[model samples]
Target: MADPNEPVHVTTTEARAGATPGVTRYVLGVSLVLVIAIFAFLILR
Candidate 1:
């Protein structure tokens, strides 16, 4: 087996081919905030 610590190679094209993980995290954070706001509004009413 190869060394696990060896650096893997990624082509430039491959690097740009996928959706960024940051965007997904941001979306999830926004949705969670919205859900919390909605719950708070309902509770306050």
Candidate 2:
């Protein structure tokens, strides 16, 4: 039998481990966009 009101504990390392790849990908995507925009501005100006 499971307790309906019981709180489950998640380890910080386990939680962050899953999210690390996603965060890395997001940062890379943003950085690439910023680089392209800066280059375009420099070429146009």
Candidate 3:
């Protein structure tokens, strides 16, 4: 178990490098789902 009170430090470049790709993929997935839902709604309506 890790200590909850420990202070963790991350550099900007490291944070961006690690997070950007995953965040981009998540955003893209959500956007694709929304677009598909909207398209289906339009077609069915």
Each prediction's RMSD over C-alphas, in Å, is 4.8, 4.7, 6.2
lDDT of 1 by residue, 1-45 (tens): 999999989987697997565788889999999999999999999
Ranked by lDDT, the better of candidates 2 and 3 is: 3
Q: Cα deviation of 26 in candidate 1 (Å)?
A: 0.3
Taking the candidates one at a time, how many backbone clashes does each contain?
0, 0, 0
On a 0 to 100 scale, what is the lDDT of residue 44 in model 3?
Answer: 100
Q: Assess every candidate by TM-score.
A: 0.53, 0.54, 0.54
Deviating ranges (above 4 Å) for candidate 2: 1-21
Give the Cα RMSD of candidate 1.
Answer: 4.8
Candidate 2: tens digits of C-alpha lDDT, residues 1-45: 889899878899776775555688889999999999999999999
Candidate 1 at 30: error in angstroms? 0.3
Worst 10 residues of 2 by lDDT: 13-22
lDDT of 3: 0.88
